[model samples]
Target chain A: MQWLHAVPWDLLLIQTINGIVTGMILALVASGLTLIFGIMDVVNFAHGEFLMLGAYIAVLTIVATHNFWLALIIASLGTGLIGALVYVTTLRPLLGRDPLTTILATFGVSLVLQNYALWQFGPVARKIPEPFSGSITLFHLDYSLYRLMIAGLSAAIIGGFWLFLKFGTWGIWIRATTQDRIMAQAMGIPVPWVLAGVFAIGSAMAGASGVLFGPLVGVDHAMGFDWILRAFIVVVVGGMGSLGGSVLAAIFISLLEAYSSLWVSPAQAGIISFVVLILTLLFRPTGLFVATPK
Target chain B: MTLKDLDKGQVTRRRVLAASGIGLGAAVLSPMPLRYALAQSKPYRIGSEQPLTGVAALGGKTALVGLQMAVDRINKAGGILGRAVELIVADDESKPDSGRRKVEKLVTEDNIDAHVGGYLSNICLACVPVFTENQVVNMISVCLDTTLTTSKCNKYTFRPYDFAPSQAKAFAPHLVNKMGKRWFIAYADYSWGQSTRDAYANEIKGNGGSVVGTLGIPLGTADMTPFLSKISGDFDGLFLIFFGPDSINFVNQGTDLGLRKKYKWAGDGAVAVASQLPALGDKIEGFVGVDRYVPVFDPPLDTPYLHAFYDEAVERLKKAGLENAAPDRYVQSNFEAMNALKLGIEKSKFQGRADSEKLIAALEGLEMKESADFPTGDKLLRKEDHQAFVRETIFEMREGKYHLLDTIPWQKSEVPPACTFA
Candidate 1:
């Protein structure tokens, strides 16, 4: 009771908002990565590069147009097109090869893309202006309205993607491919095209998250690096290829990290996520969010 | 027939001609400058390891430019000790392991006489041992971790620029008097940041101010807002210790969370490097910080040398695709560090790695004058700690330009040496 009384309630309230907002952004990024792995069985080491590409596209788009929405749309479309081209040119030929081949190929691709971004953009970080500049009082701090908008926008995007994966015809094809690629191909589902389309969608989602996140941090070549690691954690913890699980795990992990900051230092708090990852792997190999088999 | 062809003592005309031709070809093929090869044959091989394509690539690229500029200048002035200085560079890829490996190669394989580079502190710390083991002089360019000259100081390594404690000593009075009394410190949560934070905190306390709280955000933490959201309550100002993209990220996110409006913002000069200002836009307005060098042509720094250095740097940076970017501290410090090595070599008459002791002794109390080589200012590299205390300039950002506020002399900013060389 004494320890509870000493706890800063205001900090708790503030961290809740922080956790939720941060979780939504993480979920958006993880959704694309998990979606790709789920459908294609290709663990894209280049997923982060796609995210970086989206932010770079958004930077150019915003600079020319000064419209955040236009930038978001253009960046998503641009990254999606690039993703499709990547699939056809690189990933397609190595589809039936050993899993290690695809992994190495994507790793090679990541290096090329990262170096290319460094060469093209140089090392200086770029800026993307937020559309809204308003804030609301939240405890002792006045939080930026743009942060809340990012959370809301991410949710909306994820929600719309969920709907597409549920009822839409193309969504059925993707689900069918995820379940049985051979049967889907036999059923005249255009398996190769579906795979290409799924990659584009996954890449588009990554781009959207990148643009949304650009305003919070400098748009640099390595910006995607920091997020993609955590996204991998979220994917593994939520059950890889489980979009629903990834979303749930993202929020849970973020909240845990947020709450841990109260009792421990940030470096210690940061370690809790990795600890959780290790524990889950040891105890529940199927992932904490996945349904265990009887 | 074999014994006749092997003839060790035979001095036939054909054999002599063949031997002479082989010797001439070998001399011509040698990497040493042909003119210098005539007088003093061996070149002084200098190696630099930098994060050429990783997280710290921006500063690393700029640092390389400065080092090259110095080497070019040294060579143009008829080389050091009448021997041409050859520079060998290795890319560390911004990882400690890679940095150490590169340094090992630079030492054993390249057989470099000296080294002059480091951008990231951890990478620098990792490679310090390689330099020590090989008995090579290391002129650290831009790594500002306090322990480099303190607990972790080595005989082989020397930081020829300002570090955290001195910067803190120079700026804490201004921060306490002009800014607010109670402060919250946020830092990059790494080797450099943690050391810098402690230095500032101690200085602030010494100056009759209070450090209300401190937060250390892990390097490359995607969103600092979560960590920043924890920063609230009674704090008069927010002091930041970060560099590169981390600086831009923290400022952007912290401002987004209204921390900017709530508290007076001040930090390490790295937060507002000239290249990063365009990205920061108007957000950096009114932020006060301290640095040894800023790319402004003000009094004391308005010399013709600085102008020449600035013009060439600007043109080079433009060619490197950082168009219109002013040379940052990385560029300034690296240029000076290399030049300092040249001066040391010239004074010691150092030839190669065998003369490391002589070079170290000469550089111990070396005085650097304000020239193209040391365009920032005059300073002395302390014999005790191998750290130079340069004049610290406190400046404020106004319309994305650094406006000089005050300057603290090297004598005033110098802290007591705390290093014991092994």
Candidate 2:
């Protein structure tokens, strides 16, 4: 009882808020990665680089225009274009290859993108000016309004994406492509074009996530690397290609991170997630949301 | 008959004369400058390798800023040895092998007279052998792993910053006397962190402070809950020896767990970075740490030159909109190192590669009074270990700001005598 009360309620709440904000962003990035992996059977290791490119675009746009919304649009579109180009140039040629080849190729692409970014930006952390600056007091706790807004926006985007994936025409095509690419192609669906479109949309989502995260986390070349590990863990724990699982796992991991920091320490929080991952693999390799192998 | 015919090659003499005439004509009438002109126009090159795109990018960028600033200042002051310094910078990406390769490229291709900049201890350790092999002077700006100075110390490597043992020795007595006698240490499980923890533990015990517990977590850990929980029961002071983003995470979680209120927290220069203070907020209040520089130092004499440097740094940061940003120890250390290097160069009258060794030799006994730009006191760079015996400032965070509590002046301290070259 004493230990329970000893926990700093205010600090815990703040950290939880931070976690949720981070989790929402994670869900956005992971959703795109999971979608690419589901539809194309490609891990798309460069997905994080797409996010980084998005953030850099947003930073460049914001520096020029000083408008946040403009920056977001440009960042998303620019990332989508880059994603499509990546598919056409680097990925398209390697299609129908071994899974290991795809993974290794994507890893190489990621390295190329990282080095290109480093050469262009010269490794300085560029900050995107916050749109809604400062904080608001809620429940007698001061929280960054921008952070809360980001969380709300991320949730809305995720919900809209879920609805689209479930009911929309493109969503249906994506599912078909994921389930039976050969049959989908036999039915006269332009499979290659659909795959390219999916890559673009997925990479665009990652870009948008980067734009949203830029102001909160600051933009750096390595920001993509920082989140990629977590996104992989989130996707694994949520179940591969399971959008619902991704959402659930993201929240679970965030809450675990929040509560663990309250009870233990932040350094251990990462370990806890890995421990969960190991345990999940040991027991339910398909993750909490079990999915049939395609 | 065939050998004579070959030797008497009638067309060869005429062809050779014609080729020589064409070569002379091309050399005299070419659109581009001659080889001698190009050689005369080339600048003396200095090389630097840093983790420019990885986790240590910020530190690398800061070191670059210092290096460039020093180069600019030196150039403005009539240049080094009457020749302008040209810096050839490369990104090591925080990899040990990459760092060695980058140094090799710099030494072999760039023909750099001296090398500068190393943020990570691992990278520094890896590159030291390359520098030693090439007989190039390496002015290392950061990297606190004790092994860099002791076991790995080479004639070519000179560290401008105080090493781990000196930092530990500076803080331990203070922790025992001012804070408490029971100490708990939590550090990252890396060369830098391990060496720091070992040094601190030994010094704390030596200073009559008992180490109640010690915990080492892997690098890149985002959560420190279990480790913190295990040691939370009863320690008077907690010595945190983590760096970079890990330190930020630890302090935030430590605060959330109410660990700061229960025990006094002390950390190394990693925690002393002013940029990290805002992330810590009120949580870091009353937390004490050891650092090389603090903005709140009170000196008897106000040097205009120091004030100008401070004002310039503040202006540069403000223009970058990081004005309110906390001053990192690396940034301050780089500034001091630049100044120290200039002093060393001037004292030794360094003219070329041969003179760098003499400059390093002069650096061993050089001392400077802390002006506004640097802190007050004398720093003696030890000849044997190539480690600087510099003063460490003790500071406490107050209301999201750092306040200097005391200054530990440089004392001639012994290097870890047990360390030996294999």
- Indicate the residue-level lDDT of B383 in model 1: 97
Q: What are the iRMS values of all candidates?
A: 1.1, 7.2
Model 2, span A1-294: residue lDDT tens: 888879877666666776787688788888888888878888889998999999999988987999999999999999999999999988888888888888998899998988788667654456565686555553333445776777788898789888887899877888888889999999877899989988998899899988987654446666687678888998888888888888788878877876776656566566788988898899888887656568
Candidate 1 C-alpha lDDT tens digits along B126-173: 989889988999999999999999999999999999999999999999
Task: Candidate 1: list runs displaced more than 4 Å.
Answer: A1-4, B1-14, B17-39
Worst 10 residues of 2 chain B by lDDT: B412-421
Tens-digit lDDT string for candidate 2 (B335-364) = 667667667766886655767778778777
What C-alpha lDDT do the candidate models reach, one value each? Answer: 0.90, 0.75
Error of 1 at B415 (Å): 1.5
Backbone atom clashes (below 3 Å) for every candidate: 0, 14
True contacts kept of each: 0.80, 0.09
